[model samples]
Target: MSSKLNIFEFSNPSIRTLHISWVAFFITFLVWFSHAPMLAFIKEAFDLSSQQIKALLILNVALTIPSRIVVGMLVDRFGPRIVFSALLFTGSFLCWGFAFATSYEMLALFRFLCGFVGAGFVIGIRLVGEWFPAKQVGVAEGIYGGWGNFGSAAGAMTLPTLALLFGGDDGWRYAIALTGAIAFVFSFIFYINARNTPKGSTYFKPKRSGGLEVTSKGDLYFYLAMNIPMYIALAVLAWKLSPENLGLLSELATNTLYVVLLVLFVFQTSQIWKVNKEHLQKGVAEIEKYKFKQVAILNWSYFVTFGSELAVVSMLPLFFMDTFELSAVTAGLLASGFAFMNLVARPSGGWLSDNLGRKKTLSVLIAGLSVGYLVLSQIDGLWFIPLAVVATMCCSFFVQAGEGAVFAMVPLVKRRMTGQVAGMAGAYGNVGGVTFLTVLSFVDASTFFMVIAGCAALCFILVQFLDEPSGQMAEVMADGSVELIDVA
Candidate 1:
């Protein structure tokens, strides 16, 4: 494998796959966030209150937590090519529905559905993992993630101007609908161009479909325990929208939703047990067994890395505007710097992980991020604007780089279960966002930053327990033959 990335070498099928996969992911993000920049217009059109607006924001991320898990299963089963295209194609309608929504209810429903596109990130992780060799997988996944993730910033930068170009009360509607159209057309393009795997390589599927397969009884319990936080995050979202918070849901409805979530958790636990019981009872082959703790640590790592990214991106603009009394446009432009770092910082993180060793690179990045957030916690109205901007951008780099480093290790965890693993980790990223943002509602900016810093410190400690990937992971072929995939 080349130490340098020759991304322009399209003659290489891996390069071509990398290019197309990132574009698909980019468009998914663009479509998923198309409504964000247009929210002001939508709010005006619907005459939405502050609470209603907040509810819409909550609704946007509400479904993505579980969607990643479900999409992971689908990706592992049907492969990324079909699943990603389907998600984009189906999400197009959801985007369009939100665009032309006549009522807040319609808008809310469509936005909630649009959240499904957020899971598209998990699909590409599996796809990229399948195509790239382990030596290059980290950088490849980083490029896919870093560049593809820029779609949100792109939407923020362009969609509002696009709405202006359309010129009317409904301009925002047209702007958003256009994003859907792009996604709809690109879905076919992606389907046509993308392959499940490189020629002559097998695409491994999970032995069972309903839940992640576990090697040991302890891991089975660990997997189930890890699931609790996702449900708890959902419950927090429910509480936020309940009568006590935003009043979007009545007590009865909130309680019903809680019951429904509980029931689903029970059902999922049963599925997990059903999927792994035989394996646990009989014991997994030594060659086939991989540690679940790797996944758990990565999950927490993402919870802090990508989680803080989501949470901070949501509030940074406001934090800047409120703290410095800056113009909204100026604050927004400055805040955009945070997301823009994804382009270079993420890939750099991946490259570092590839060369510097994954665990060491991730730990260093997390430690830096903790310190970065701690610095951010000190920013106040008296701070120099230029200095604050630099501080913010510096922190932003580590936050995104940490994300790059985390995913850099994901595919190597278990090749056959890459999708499930990525799904869980990706879901935790959303969980982090929800948890941090929820904390923000109850505290000041300094406290929020400190909380994230604390989480990062804890994650840094937890990451110490992660064993670096080496040797090869064994997967069973369709004909029941075993093949070894290199991880080191």
Candidate 2:
């Protein structure tokens, strides 16, 4: 595949696939977050309490952590083309249901279910990775992620105006339903237009199903250890919604959810062991071994990068409004500059990774991320508005670009399991979001910034252990032939 990509090259199948995949992802995100900008209207309409509002926020992202993992595995098994379309199709009804929900309970259930749409990001990772070659995959994935992610911002910017255009108590409902309608239409468009691979290229599948396969017993343990954080993040979210905290969940309900999480974790661990046991017992070939640490380290990298982005984006408008004494609209616009950077920064991260080498590029960006957060830790009433906005955007560039860099390495890790790898890494991003945001509920904004800066420091240390991709990786064809894919 050529390294050059032209956005206007609609005649090219690969270019066309990129456009379709990104649009599918964009619509999912728009539908997923469409509830956010119209929350004020929903609150008045439903007579929601402050606690109920906070519960809605928590519920929105509640399912995403596991859904990404499940979606990732599905993509690996069924191919991105089907999984991507199916996810969008399923999420559309959930979106519409949430839109028309008449009660808080109905709203909470659908909002939690809508979290499934967040997994849409995991699907595009594998799809773009398949369509583009190693030399260009980074930028290709970056463009897919960066531009596609704009849906949230677009929802934030446009959804309210759309509601006003509809003009009534039910206006927000129609606005949200319209997003679902678009998602419904595009799911079919994606199913028809997206190709799993370029004609004749093999679509690889993992040798075993049920769980991610690891090479060594040591890696088996490491993979299991990494799974704990995702559970812990969920547990923490439950605790946040428990009677003592936000009081959205009754104590009995919270305890039941905790037990459910524990049971699920145990079940998942067994599935993982079952998947890797035979190979570990018989001793796998050297050629098949890839370090699980690569995935673990990348998980933590995203934990800080995209995780901070989620946590910060949620709080930024408030942070700006309070610290800078700006109006809600002004603060929201300035805060949006952080997300706006995703358009250029993510692709730039991928392009730099492609050109400068993945490890080196990610390292520099992460180091900058640490610095950026530390600077953000100092923002207060003393800072000027424009300067603060510039600082926020600069930090976001490193944050979102770091996310692009993380996924750029994901597909390179394992060819057949790119979906699972991206899925776990994607799940970790949500884990990070939950973890960091939970931290925010306790501490002040400055402390939250410092805590993230501290996490970024840890990521910088972890990135050092990453083995840069080079030479070639080997994958087996169905008939037992070995295919070597160039990574350098």
Strongest candidate by lDDT:
1
Writing each residue's lDDT as its tens digit, candidate 1 over 218-272 gives 8999999999999999999999999999999999999999999999999999999
Evaluate model 2: give its TM-score: 0.99
Model 2 misplacement above 4 A? none
Q: Count the backbone clashes (under 3 Å) in each candidate.
A: 0, 0
TM-score to true structure, per model: 0.99, 0.99
Q: Write the per-residue lDDT of candidate 2 for residues 1-488, one digit (tens) a residue.
A: 66777889999888899999889989989998999999999999999998899999889998999999999889999998899888888998999899999888999999999999999999999889888889998888999999999999999989999999999889999999999999889889899999999998998999888789999999999999999999999999899999998998899999999999999999999999999999899998788789999999999999999999999999999999999788999888889999999999999999989988999999999999999999999999998878989999999999999988998899999899999999999999999999999899889999999999999999999999999998888899999999888877
Query: What does candidate 1 score on TM?
Result: 0.99
lDDT of 2 at 96: 89
